[model samples]
Target chain A: MAVEKFLVEASHIMMFARSVGDANQIYYDADYAKTTEPGTIIAPPTFAQSSAQFDPDYFLRPKIGEPWFGSGKEPTGIKRESSGGGGGGGGGLHAEQHFEYHRHLHPGDVLSATVKPGKTWEKESKRAGKLVFSESITEYRDQHGELVITARGVGVRTERPVDSK
Target chain B: MALKASNLRVGDTHSVCIVEDLKRTQIVQYAGSSGDYNPLHTDEIFTVKVAGYPSVFAHGMLTMGMTGRMLTDYVGDGRLTKYGVRFTNQVWPGDTLQATTTVEEVADGIVKLKVETTNQNGVSVLSGYAEARVD
Candidate 1:
């Protein structure tokens, strides 16, 4: 489903930049950014808005209870294996990610990010037993209703359930 | 400043960027603001003992975000049409990452770029490309 999200404040961009612990003057001093090469403060690449996973109404979120990574009811289709480590396979891993920007994002851009279900599959793994792979595709449109960014992410989970040892 | 779209050719090159070293505390702050509390990244004990890893590591997105810094610093407010990277390796504390971009193509007012990020050992942590409007 396509959902809309507001930037809330231009400061969100700065906060994200600071959170990353990057003291790049451009992300901070607005006047410096204004006089510099780009001539304006702009969101860093992979800015907070580029992530649909952060959206409260994202698709992976089940309508019922607290958000969980695996299936809500039970794990059925996922292959199960009890082998030990060797293939770097693990229950929890962020396998891959990609982001495409149609335009730069400014603070306060009311962006709508629509997360559409993407291709998912399973493969064998040596370390984590079996690995399930999935992607959630999202498109971000700015306040003017122009597509500004497209984000794609790959999620990987181990066949074994998360446990404490 | 980003080069004019017209000035970008397939072989045009942007200088390399050396990012600040990753500190221990930034990991926690990032988790707080980004709302991603993956223990593998934030909890030292979890990473070393629970996860059976050597030590706590920075999020790939954090490195990717620093790579994003390279893009923004170079393009200066230019629009990025596409930016993506595969997390090839982990960035440990005290590792200083660096990245560089090359113009791959220019057409229809779009400048295509290839970006690569590497660690102090010259080991690649992430690699990808991006397209942005510079004209």
Candidate 2:
């Protein structure tokens, strides 16, 4: 996925920090932040994942005039040709995630993300059946064209719903 | 405050209760902010009837995000240079989570850590490692 522009604003960081239950002043209180080490409000560690908000073609978000996969009047808004798969309730599950921070983000940083597909592999599991995992690596760059963070994620598609036990 | 290398030990550990009784509302909040509106996270009917899960579950990123709070609180804000994790189990609503980080190594002004998050039942849900700059 390529996102041309991701505006990192203070409110978004505050909301993201709240959603994750982080109460750190550096994440929300700019006044308090000025006295701290960073000397400014900083984004949370995992905040860069929200770059999906700027991805025009991000499939997980419902686009206008597009039929979503979630429920409407019925159990699902879209029809499925077959059942099963999606262990914890989606097309695929996040198997792994990794991030390397060249620099942390603060409000007002305009960023962009470029993605590269990494690897694909398969594994058999007793609880989830056959699992196919694919990886993607994303590089986030600030407006200055400096690489800010590198993210690697692996997604797994299971043959059937995973056994909860 | 940032960790001082001189005061750190290889096995020094810090733990925090990341979330208690994880709520679906919080999951929705994460979905809204993260822009990952996957039905498996907030749409219980579709998740139960179509996707065949017991119920809607938390996004792996949500768990990671919450765990990140623990990391930053321990290592100090903006101190982390690397953080990564593998989802080992599903996190459902009503589950309490605890995250722990152990110092694995500290050298050259950087500290390496072993990170693990577990559910109330002591089942490991996420496991990984992190590296951070220290004072």
Of the candidates shown, which would achieve the greatest DockQ relative to the real structure?
A: 2
TM-score of each: 0.75, 0.98
What TM-score would chain B receive for each of the candidates shown? 0.91, 0.99
Residue B41, candidate 2: alpha-carbon lDDT: 93
The residue pairs in collision within model 2 are none
Instruction: Name the runs in model 2 displaced over 4 angstroms.
Output: A83-90
Q: Model 1's CAPRI class?
A: acceptable
Docking class of 2: high
What clash count does candidate 1 reach?
11
User: What is the fnat of model 2 with respect to the true interface contacts?
Assistant: 0.88
lDDT of each: 0.67, 0.93
Q: In order, what fnat does every candidate score? A: 0.40, 0.88
